[model samples]
Target: MFRVQKLLVFEFEAIYEPVLVEGPVVLVDAQGNGLRQYHMALTSRNVVFSCDNLFKNSTRRGPSDEPSWEGRGQDPEIECLELVSLVPLECLRFNFYRRGDRCLMMLSAHQAHQHLNVKEPMIFEFGGHNFKHHFWYTWRERVASIRVVQPRYSEITGSSPFSSSDVQLEEELTVQVQVHPRPIRSSSGIFVRCYSSSGEGY
Candidate 1:
C-alpha cells in the first residue's frame, strides 16, 4: 500500500511540475457561442492546448525502492500527445478579466496566427481567488515592461510645442493718440484715430 501511494504521488508531481496554470478554455464566436473546448496548460515557454488526450500518456516509473505494479514495470520511451494549438513565447498582447469566481485571459500578437485569436477571444476560465490574483500580477508586469515612446521633435530642438489653435502674434506694440478739441457751429467735437505697424491701434 505504501509503494502504491508513492508511485501515484510521483506521477502527479511530474505531470504538473512545469505547468503554471492549467484549466479549461473555450473558444467563443462573435455571439459568445462556444466554438470548441480545450484543456490548456500555460508554461513559461508556451501555451499548450490539448484536446481528447490529456495526461493519458504521462505515466512513468517511480524510484527503484518503490515497488511498481504489474503494468508499470518498464518506463515507456515514447508517449502520445494530441495538441490543438501551441502558442510560443512571443504572445504580444494580454488581457484578462474576472467574472464572479472565474478568470478569463486573452492572448494575441502582431499576427493572428502567432497567437490565439478569434471573433471573440478564447476565454480561459479558472477558479480560485488566490490563483486569479497571482495571474493578474504576473501578466501585468510582463505587459508593463514593453514601453512605446512617441517621437517628439520639440524635445530635440529645445522649443516648446504649441498647437495650431494656440498661435499668437510674435510682437506687441503700444500707440499713443493725442486728441485736440475743435469748435463747430453749435457743439465742438473731435475724434483722433491712431495705428501702429506693430499691430496696436487706438
Candidate 2:
C-alpha cells in the first residue's frame, strides 16, 4: 500500500505539476457566446504563442507532460510564435483597466528582454484583476506566477476575435518582473516551458 501510494503521488505530480495550460484559453464576451481564444506559452526569455490555430473551442487546465512522440497532444497542428522580445532579467511594467465594477488587465513594456518589432508590438492582457502578484516581481524571485487570460474589449461585443478596437487604457500598475539570476535560487520554484525554449522556466 505504501508503494502504491508513492506511485500514485508520482503520477499525480506528473499530471498536475505547477504549470499553466498548453491549450487555448477560451474567451466569451460579456453575454457569453461564441468567443475568441489566445494560446500563450511563456519562457524565461521569451513568451511564445501558437498563431496557426487560434480561437479554439477547447479549455484545458494544466499542460500535458506526455511525450509528443506518442502522437497525442493538444493542437498538434499549432504554429508556434515567439514574442522574442522578453528579457527575464529586467522590469516588466503593468497597466490596469477598470470601468466601475468591470476590471481588466493589460501589461506592456519590459526593462530587460526588449526585442519586439517596433512596428507591431504584442500587448499581454488579462481578463480580470486581483492577481497582480503573479507578475509584480522580479523574475529571479523564489516563485512567480504566469497567468493566461482572455481579453474582453469593451467596445467589441462578440465580434472578430482579433478586432482592433479603440483601447481605453488607464494608469500604470508597475511590477518588477525580472532580476539578476542568483546562485542560491531554488530549482523547485516556478518554471516556464514553451516551444523551442524548454527546461525549467526563467
Candidate 3:
C-alpha cells in the first residue's frame, strides 16, 4: 500500500539563555493547600518558572476493589509558565545565619509573587534559626502564548514511505533548567552554587 502519511514537525525555532539577574528562587503556591513549589530560572530574554506536583499516592479502586490513597494509581500534575518578555527589578537576597534569619526582596511584582505571597508570613528554619518573613508581588508578570497541533494535510498523486523526493528535517535542543535555592547569602550579591546538578552555570 502506497499512501501519504501526515507526519508533521515543529520545534523551538530559537532559544537563548537569560542573563543572571537573580535566580534559583523557590516560591510556594499560597493559593493551594499543599503549597506547591514554583522554581524560578532567570535569564536576560525570559524568566522560566516550572513546578511539579507529584502526589506520592493517589486514591483509586485497587486490585481488591478497595479505595486507596496510599501511593496507588496516579501521576502528579506538572506544568510550566514562561515569560518571553522580561523586566529587571530591585531584587535582593539576605541571610543572617548567625542571627538565624533570612529575607526576600523583589521590587517588581510578577506572577512568581503568588507563590511567595507577602501578605502572609513565610516562616521556616534558616542558618540554624527559626525565621519568618513576608513577600509581596505588586504586579503579575505574564506573557500570552498559544499552541496548536493538527495533522498536516497535503495532496500527492503517489506518496509512499520509500519516496525520497521530499524530506522533513527537525532539530531539537533540550534545555533542562536547573534550579538551586541556597539558604545562605553573602554581602556581595546572589549566592549561586558552583557545582550544580548539571555542572553548568548560566
Candidate 4:
C-alpha cells in the first residue's frame, strides 16, 4: 500500500488589472461592442478618451515621435496613443446602472454645459462583477466630489440643445476638432499588478 501525501490547494478570486480600474478603461458601445479598441480615463479633474494598441503586439515609432494616423503602413504593434476626446470634469454628468449580469457607467454632458463635443453619452462597461461594489464606490467618490447631474433620457428625445438641428449649428460655431496620436509612455495613476491563473485579466 502506498501512502498518499497531503495536497494543498491555493484558491484565489478573479479581478481586473489595476490599470483597467484606475487609468484606462476599455470603452464599449450601448450594445457592449468595443469602440474601435479605444480606452478612456476618468479622473477627478477631467475625462480623456484615447485610442491605442498598448495591449497589442507592435512597437514602431512614427515620424515626429508620435503615432501617425496618416497611413496604415504604421506598425500595428506600435502602441500608438491617439487622443480621441477630452472633456472637462465640470462639463459632464454621471450615471450607473445594472443590466442583466453587467454593470454600466454612463458619462454625458452636463445640462448647463453645451460647448462639449459629445453628442451622446459615452458608456463604459464594468466586467468585474465581483468588484462592482469596489468599482462603483471608487468612481462614485470621484464623481460625487463634483456636482454632476444624472443624465435624462427624455432630454435626448425632447427639445434639447443637442437636438439634431443644433448639431450643425454647434459644429459651425465650434473649432474643428483634431485628433493627434502620441506615444503613451505611462498612463496616469498608480498601477498594481493582479495575478490570474490564466495569465489574463479584464
Candidate 5:
C-alpha cells in the first residue's frame, strides 16, 4: 500500500569520525497494499526527530458524499525509509490506505564500509510475511579499521513466551561478506511479504 512515493537524500556532519550512533531507521510495509497509518520518533542525547502519520485523509480529496473518505485505509504492505539527518523528517509519515490492510514494517541500515560494489538482495521475514529491501552507504572515514553495529530490534514492548533454556524453534541464516576501503554504495533488492488473511490483528 504505502510504497516509496519518493526518496530525498541529504548529507550532514557528525561529531566523531565513524560516530558511535544508532543507525538510521527504515520502515517498510510487509503487506504492500491498502492504507495504513504510521508514527515514528527518533532522538539522541541532544538531537531529536519526531513525526506522526504524515499522510492522512486531511491532505487528499475524497468522495463528495463522504469527503473524508480519502482512500486512507490499510495496505497489503507499506515501505518507509527515514534518513536521520534530513530536514523534513517530520513529513515522512503518510497513509498507504489503498493497500494498508496487510503491511510489514522493516528497519535496517548499512555502513559506509560495507557499501562497495555489492549487488545482492537481503530478505527478512516476520509476522507471516517476507519483506525485502536493499542497503547502501558511503564510507568517508580514513582509518583503515571501522566498526558498525546494528540493533537486532528497534523496540520491544512485552516479554516473549519462549525462555532461554527452551529448545529454539526458529531457523537462522548467515551471510559472509568481504571488506574493502572506498566510498561505496550497496543496493539491496526489493522486499516482498505475503499474507494468507487480511485485516489488522498482527
Candidate 6:
C-alpha cells in the first residue's frame, strides 16, 4: 500500500530573462546496485512566453559512468522526455507584475508530472519559474506508496525584480500516502492549493 504523509513546497523568483533551463526535480530510489533513472513531464500555460525558448535537460552520474547528457549538445539517448496522454486543463493563465520597470511572470494553475525508474536518484532543473500546485495520478494501480518532500523556494537574481521581500508565507505541510498496488483503479486526483499569509488563495 502507498500512503502520503509529507508535502514539500519550493518557491523562488525568476531573475534571468527566459532562457533554456534544464535539470532534474525529483530523485527516485534505486534498489541496490547504485544505478538511477529519472523521468519528467512538463506543461505550461499558453502565455506570451516562448515555449521554444524553454528547454528541459538532465544529467545522470553512476558510480562508474561519466555524467551523461539528456538534451542539447548531445550524446544521443533520445533525450526527449515523454509527455503523458491525459485530459488537458480547461483553462490556463499567466499572472504578470512589474517592479521598477521589470516584468515578472507567474504560472497560475500550472501542473506537471515526472516518472522515473525506481532504481535511481532523480534530480532536475527548469528554464523558467516552475510552481508546483498539484499532483496527478496516472498509473494508480501500480503505485504502492507516495511521499512528497516539501518544496523550498529561492529567487535567482538578474532574472526579475520580484524578491522574497515581496511576499510572506508559511512552510507547507508535507504529504504522505499509502495505497493498494492493485484493484483496477483509474483517475486518482489530488491538487495543491496555495494561499498567501493574508488569506488569499492564489
Q: Name the candidate that leads on lDDT.
A: 4
Query: How well does candidate 1 match the true structure in TM-score terms?
Result: 0.37
lDDT of 1 at 159: 15
Alpha-carbon RMSD, each predicted model: 34.3, 15.1, 23.5, 18.9, 16.9, 19.9
TM-scores for the candidates: 0.37, 0.27, 0.24, 0.44, 0.19, 0.20
> What would the per-residue lDDT of candidate 2 be over residues 16-81, giving only the tens digit for each residue?
122221223222343333243344433432333333322233344446532232333433343122
* Among all candidates shown, the one with the greatest TM-score: 4
lDDT of each: 0.37, 0.29, 0.24, 0.41, 0.22, 0.22
Overlapping backbone residue pairs in candidate 3 total: 7
Deviation of model 3 at 178, angstroms: 10
- Using lDDT as the yardstick, the better of models 2 and 4 is 4
**Candidate 4 overall Cα lDDT vs. reference?**
0.41
Q: What is the lDDT for 174 in model 2?
A: 48
Candidate 5's displacement at residue 15, Å, is 14
Q: Write the per-residue lDDT of candidate 5 for residues 1-202, one digit (tens) a residue.
A: 1122111111111211122121222233343432322222222111122223333323434444322334555332221233223211111111111123232222222232132221221111212123221111111011001211212221210111122432222333422222212223343333222111111232
lDDT of candidate 4 at residue 125, scale 0 to 100: 69
Candidate 1 worst ten-residue window by lDDT: 193-202
- Please, what are the lDDT tens digits per residue for candidate 6 over residues 1-202? 0101000111111111111111222221222121222222222111111111113344544455545453446323233332221112122222223233222223333232112111211221221223331121111111111111211111111122223543222244434333222233332344433221110111
Candidate 1, residues 1-202: lDDT per residue as tens digits? 1121122123332222244444445555434455565555544444556544324444435433433233644333212224455555444335555454444555444353432333233444443345544444343332333221213211211111122332221232322212222212332233222111110110
Q: Give candidate 3's error at residue 168 in angstroms.
A: 56
RMSD of 3: 23.5
Task: For residue 65, give model 6's deviation from the true position in Å.
Answer: 3.7
TM-score of 4: 0.44
Candidate 1 stretches greater than 4 Å from native: 1-17, 53-81, 100-102, 112-120, 127-202
lDDT of 3 by residue, 1-202 (tens): 0000000001121332322322223332222122323334334223333333232233444555544345433221211122222222212111111122233322223344433233333221211112122111100111101001111211111222123542211233323323323223223433221111110110
Model 5 error, position 94 (Å): 23
Better of 1 and 4 by lDDT: 4
Q: State each candidate's clash count.
A: 0, 6, 7, 5, 53, 45
Error of 1 at 89 (Å): 2.2
